[model samples]
Target: MPKTEKSSMSWLLRVIPWNTTVVLFALAVTAVLLLGVHYYMEGLISIGTLFLIYQYTQMLNDPIEMLGDQVQEFQKAKSGMLRSRELLSMRSEIEEGKEEQLPQGPLGLEFSQVHFSYNPDKPVLQDINFTIKPGERLGIIGRTGSGKSSLSRVLLRLYNLDRGTIRVGGTDITELSLQALYRRVGMVTQDVQLFDGTLRDNLTLFNSDVSDHMIKETTDRLGLSQWIDSQPQGLDTYLAAGGASLSAGEAQLFALTRVFLTEPSLVILDEPSSRLDAATEGMLQSAIDQLMKQSTGVIIAHRLATLEKVDRIMVLGDGKVLEFGAREELASNPASHYARLLITGREEELA
Candidate 1:
């Protein structure tokens, strides 16, 4: 159903019962008053008795209204419970891998003949194949819905593939535990999450093992030292939940800082600067450069300019690899997709 139609239905569901209860109560009160007057007029009851009955009828009003309110609350609680139960009962489609550890150091990534789809008939990734050597950076460019983000999702094991295998450091990803896999691969997206706590807490994720000096060093490396100095309490400064006090550029920097601390073997940048202005993006790009130097990087970017620093480029179309080669080689070839995007300045549109 459309969101607007669903909202209207929900509004009606809430109001109809309340209105019906009110109208029924009014009718019952009117009926009682009419019957009381008839009895009094026919000499079946005294004026004092009629007055007493009317008083009793008024006394029932509070309890009746309370009952209606209770019913409404009950319905709300029941609906919430049902939804919660549905979520709780659901299981992850990706099975837990064997409790094995991933190899240490920079890890190479490989995807071979991979196929995946949310629905069986409609595929999102089809026969996708690629490889990145340890310590090499690869830039991925594709139009929206061309599976740029899906590549990251599958690498993270957020979803299981319908066919084929993904390997990290010559070992199938499915052979490593989810914890081990996550510890080796880190991803930074445009949506950075912040908690309601001190800046230090958000940076360290409340981990006491991370010293203040290390935090300061990482921030300085990422060009966040000036921003930190501006805060009244430095690291102790408290931020509102969900990054309410920080600008979009600041939030992206925060996410990058987290990835730096972890020092993962592989880093995925899924258009982390897509929402920022040019000046802010330039600052972020420098930080990203620092990050790429320390790990194998996969940059999924809509803007071709962001891919300039990457060693190689991969172009995706309809979930299939259209072009894959060294960045310089593709840029020099006039017929290459990357070259065409660069010449026409339509990388964003094509991506």
Candidate 2:
């Protein structure tokens, strides 16, 4: 069947009523008008037909509503399962650092001939191709919903692109195990998600095998040591649900420490400070700068100033790579939409 036809039928099946009140009302009205119509034509009308139709409708509506309720309950159950699963999940369970594939080798990354869309014909990233050398810090700036998140997903292979190839460290990501992929990459989002556990648990992600000294060093460098000290049990104090026990900056500090403990080869941060105040953002930025000192990284930010000192900037618009080059070159060329927008976003920041 055609898509529209199927959709309409499904809607009608879902929406039509089955109750006898409507059927009886129709029957009564028809009866009242029967004499005029019967005398005008050969008589062929009955209340039984309406009654039978109403009975069938009742049968259909009962199971339809019941099935709908079941579907909703099933979704709620799935959501609950995931919530509990994350509570049990470990954010990090291993130690830091990986040696370069070769001595001073390029931790190169590439995306070739990629295409993606949430739905067909509405592609988000089109024929994308780019390469970033090892230890290169690239700033990715795009208008809201300009496929920035999709690009990240493609890099992580969250969903397969319609067509493309992606390589990390000279090996096709398709050929690499997800475990290795994650070990090679780390990320922090706008919101820091802390489990209901101790400060050390959140920092080391409950890895009993990891040394306390390593956790302490990572936390101390990220300035989480003071927060830990403030707690009654020091590193052993329970982190309330979502880290509610700690202030926003303190929670972010813990998150940075967690990432630092792993010290993945490539770090991706997506608006990690978008939700924080000036002081917390400054603290987080400082920690992040320290963390990125020797790693390949991608920072996706809305404000150009957040990425001012990064090696290169790629600006995207309407799912296409609009302008990409050195930040200085982009800053010099105001004719580009990206430069214009950066100039505008900066002005607003100042205002």
Candidate 3:
């Protein structure tokens, strides 16, 4: 159906009934008042009885208005349910792979001849090719919509590529089971979701197997021990849903702690410190540096300064690799995109 027509139809569906009910209510009240006045003037009813009839007419107003409100609410709920069911009934694009486990240790990652798009005509990634050696850190710099986050999505198999292969530790990711793939590859982003639960439950995601000792150890490693200690109930503290009581930085720390527990072979940081304040970014940076040391890391950042610890840098533009080389090489070359961004102080301006 045409979107405009559909929208008009929906708006009419909602507005028409309410309007009709309001019109009917007004007419009924007017008729009651007119008749009550006439009956009182003709001595068929007393003034007190006329007033009582008017009061009774007014009484219907509440329920009539309430009925209109309920009708609108019911329509909204019906539309939402249909959408939810449609989503639920859709098939997954990804086909489960046969391999059950990823290789042990920091896994090298490679992408070859990759292309992807949400729509056929507008590609988000095009012929992307790169490799990160096992245990090496790669910082990806790109403007918004430059496919930085899309790379992470494909790496985690959230979306199947239109073409080409992604290999981790020499095994094609398409051959790995979704469970095994996710277990070995992890990504942390700026937005953190915290449920209404104790700090322990939020951190462990209610997993009983994650021992208190391990949680404590990870917290200590991430330098979050002090923060946790300051909490009124420490690990036992009950957090409001959506991390309402936690600052943006603290919520990110929780996200890092959860990823740390997974002990992924490859960790991707998708602008984790973007929303953080200077002091919190420093703390997050410290935690990230420590995390990077233990796994194959991919740091996606808008600022070049964030890539200081990276071994290599990849610059992307318009879904293509604009530059990819050792960080030192790119930084020293004045003609390089990375060098130009540094000289112009436009690193943070990229996004």
Candidate 4:
């Protein structure tokens, strides 16, 4: 027999012996006998005796049922404990450091000889190197699985680098505290998660430092104030689970509002307009343009049009940089991959 079949047979055999079917059959037989004795042969056994037998059988079955439930709960807890142990045993990726601060204004970023892999044997990013000047806007584009997202993850220090260093504001990112790193770098994604609270709570993220004036200012900038005003209670309006009440574009705008309030030195936007309709995408584009004006920005976009306003573009292919330079320079080169992408994008639009 095949190993899988043998394992299945073994599991069946183990389970068959401990099943409740046999006990239930025995109980049924016992109840029938007691019923017959009490009703037909009334002198030999009384109804009270029959009732006592039923009660005793029920008492015997109750603990078994309870035990089955307890066993299931125990299994669940055991699985949780194993996962917790695994997490606790793993060490943090961020190195110990006292540097808990970054530059006060827009910060530049540099990646030097960086390489990383989810599995050490299969590298996801290969010898990546790049630099973004403070307040510069760079757009990243690549085919799927091109390591575009991995670059952002490495900059955010979500995973430990297998080789090389990343510098933010002239200080090695790994040498900075995780909190400091995150506080200076912000990210916005297409799928925005809304908490179960009023609109104000979702916008401010329960941060007391965020003032109503700031919220109003940012919302106005993002063109979200009109939507807020349309609400019956404005900021006090309650959003159901995952903000089911708001449209997708509104939720995304709310996420941008959160990022704006933070005033981070750098921002990463991962296809923020990819899933939106034409009108919503236009709104997202405007908001993104405003965001880029305030901070150094890296935009990972599939659509070439979104890169029009960026200062530079980085094209990746198979986890490697195919081209990196000024958008205008890359666009003028018909032989370049970015030029091909733009031509293809334009062709698709016309088609």
Candidate 5:
């Protein structure tokens, strides 16, 4: 079920004896000994003959079974090996994960006429333009494939833009150290990736220096304290692999806690509460409120209620900024592409 144990089994299967070979060899030797004794009494055979036959049988079967074991191991190892390799080689988010040594960022992001495509001759994002001031709170919303997540990637330097310049703290991202750039940024995707470790370890990521005070403060404010309080080990509670051990809402809330602890200058959060129940969504809202307070954030939100508090909403379509301004202004106008779309999505929610 887990990678380590599965791989270990593969190695064992590859090395363990074929067993059939051992059983057959024992039977052959026993038969030879019996026949040899019979021949000795009848004066028809020598001990040398029996020894040679048994030794030759062993020499031929041992190598064959050893090869069979190796093949068995190979077969068992195949699927898991492929999965790990594919994950390692798959296209990375926006840009590759390189190390950066810089201090603070979100610095300032501007997209001046950028275009992108997942495949050649077919583009997903067309000309786009927007400037997010350092510490500016912005929300991006669009229908699926409208390029919301892609927009986050561009800002986070997951992938570089084809056209336009993306500057961080007054320097073009191309010129900044990737690791330094990322160190100052944190993100919580709709997909939360938690490790197989203690709750504290998952939260602090082994940082060790993140004070328990901060962890407690975040969970308390977000109503996570209730669950944590119930745990026998408190922060030391173990988080099962893939977070299967956690409820969907708790996992999402935990992800927020992790981002809050990181204190990145720029934080990007995809809507983890998009599918949550109202009560759970409310908890998520409180967590998000604390996260966004006095900090820079880029939110890719679907629910209009979720975007209501943002400083501004950037409406994206076909990979470009179709509308940008105060949420109130966008909502008041019934004719704008964003307004119409937002209205449509809301109606669907109500329906």
Candidate 6:
């Protein structure tokens, strides 16, 4: 049976004993009342008085039954509270050190002999080693579970590596404060999260210091100025939860705009165009191109069209690198995994 069904059954079994106890206790109380009536007032009590006594006893029993139910609900609530407490009490995986410092300016990244896993026995990234030049735009491609997303997580210091080191701007990431690392790296994922606020609030994430001119300039550069102007409220327009007023593509574009305002040295796009239609993908592509021009980009994409302008491509399989080189060079070799992917894409396009 499913685990949920089994758990429900177990809970029912626990409550059964308590319910049975309450039922037996109520019956015992009723029997005692009858015995008292028989001994003390066998001939004196009227039929009406006996009926009233029985009715009062039943009224008392009803509250006892309700108490048992309340106890069961309390038990469930306590269990949930304890689980939440356990999660809240755990320490963060990323640690801050007193002596570690971060470097400034555009940052290049290097992953050397990196290995990590959510589980100790099952590694997610194995012996990964690669370097990205300052301001280089890299395209990463692989099948599902090939560790494409994991790379971005590691760069942001979201998870510590079980082995090896990651360097940003020539300084080891582990040696830098978690705050410093995050300030330098940004990521845009497939799922776009928008808060319930105005467009400008979402873009600046409620930071009061970002000037209107800066926000407008970045939006214009990303080709979103035209759309923003068409909106009735423009930047002041209110957004519902998850940006309900906007389409998925519009939400993602808004998310991109938010990240652009930060001006991070490294940007990771984890399949930013996957959910978008062709027209939206084109818009996303154009926005991404502009964003990448000023920062080092690490794009994790499935579509070859998205990788056309990338400086290099890294293809992974089963947590290992299959090929890593210039996009043109990798696509030229028929035996290369990237070349095979391109051929497959072309065939699918024709069909």
CA-lDDT, candidates in order: 0.85, 0.70, 0.86, 0.79, 0.74, 0.81
Number of the top TM-score candidate:
1
Q: Give the C-alpha miss distance for residue 262 in model 5, angstroms.
A: 1.2
User: After superposition on all CA atoms, what RMSD does each candidate show versus the true structure?
Assistant: 4.0, 11.7, 4.5, 5.2, 6.9, 4.5
Please write out the lDDT profile of model 5 over residues 13-64, one tens digit for every residue. 6555556556776787688667777887787766777677667766777677
What C-alpha lDDT does candidate 4 achieve relative to the native structure? 0.79
Task: Identify the leading candidate in terms of lDDT.
Answer: 3
By lDDT, the better pick of 1 and 5 is: 1
A best-first ranking of the candidates according to their lDDT comes to 3, 1, 6, 4, 5, 2
Superior by lDDT: candidate 3 or candidate 5: 3
Window of ten residues with lowest summed lDDT in model 1: 271-280
Please write out the lDDT profile of model 6 over residues 14-53, one tens digit for every residue. 5886688687877877796776589547677776777777
Q: What range of 10 consecutive residues in model 5 has the weakest lDDT sum?
A: 96-105
lDDT of each residue in 45-75, candidate 4, tens digit only: 6777766766776666666766655665665
- Per-residue lDDT tens digits for candidate 1, residues 193-264, read 889999889888889999999988998998877777888998899988978798877787778888888888
Looking at model 4, which ten-residue stretch has the lowest summed lDDT? 342-351
| TM-scores for the candidates | 0.82, 0.65, 0.75, 0.76, 0.72, 0.79
Q: What local lDDT does model 5 show for residue 309? A: 77
Task: Point out where model 5 deviates above 4 Å.
Answer: 1-106, 221-223, 341-351
Which portions of model 2 miss their true places by more than 4 Å?
1-106, 230-233, 241-251, 273-275, 345-351
What is the RMSD of candidate 3?
A: 4.5
Q: lDDT of model 1 at residue 227?
A: 73
